[model samples]
Target: MRLGLIKLDHQQVSLAISKLDERAGEWALKCSTSVDLAFPTWESLKSQSLQAFSPPNQAYRVRSRFLSTRQGCLTCLRQSM
Candidate 1:
């Protein structure tokens, strides 16, 4: 199995993929990419409400809130609850 991590900031987007080691129950990084985006595009996305996005699953939504708290995204953490 594979897991993806995406980080979006005002200036850029970063993506990382990790593959699961079933035997060890660990994840290893497989690939990553980072790209700077246009300010206008970022602004458009940043301005949108979180309500516009829905988690694909309840587990993902719970993890998303936990990660948001760890990352110091208090607003996002609060909104996710």
Candidate 2:
């Protein structure tokens, strides 16, 4: 997917999306007064979110909190109390 950020009047911005191949890699294109680039997403958003907590201490804390909430949600879904 391609995401373009366009500048409008008085500091306003706009986003444009286009479909493209992931293997094509990243791209930068000039649009009038601004440059636009394509942002790529991995296969799993959850894995991406987990990776965002980089520092060991922070990652541990966040992982614990996320796992607890995820477990609760799974239990609720399974109607297992």
- What is the Cα-based lDDT of residue 18 in candidate 2? 31
CA shift of 14, model 1, Å: 50
C-alpha lDDT score of every prediction, in listed order? 0.35, 0.35
> Which residue pairs show backbone clashes in model 1?
none
Runs in model 1 lying further than 4 Å from the true structure: 1-56, 70-81
Q: Best-fitting candidate, measured by TM-score?
A: 2
Off by over 4 Å in 2: 1-56, 70-81
Which residue pairs in candidate 2 collide?
none
lDDT accuracy of residue 39 in candidate 2: 24
Tell me the tens digit of each residue's lDDT in model 2 across 1-81.
222343332112122213322422122122223322122333222243345434658867876776566454484334544
Local accuracy of candidate 1 as per-residue lDDT tens digits, 53-72: 34448578787766666435
TM-score of 1: 0.18
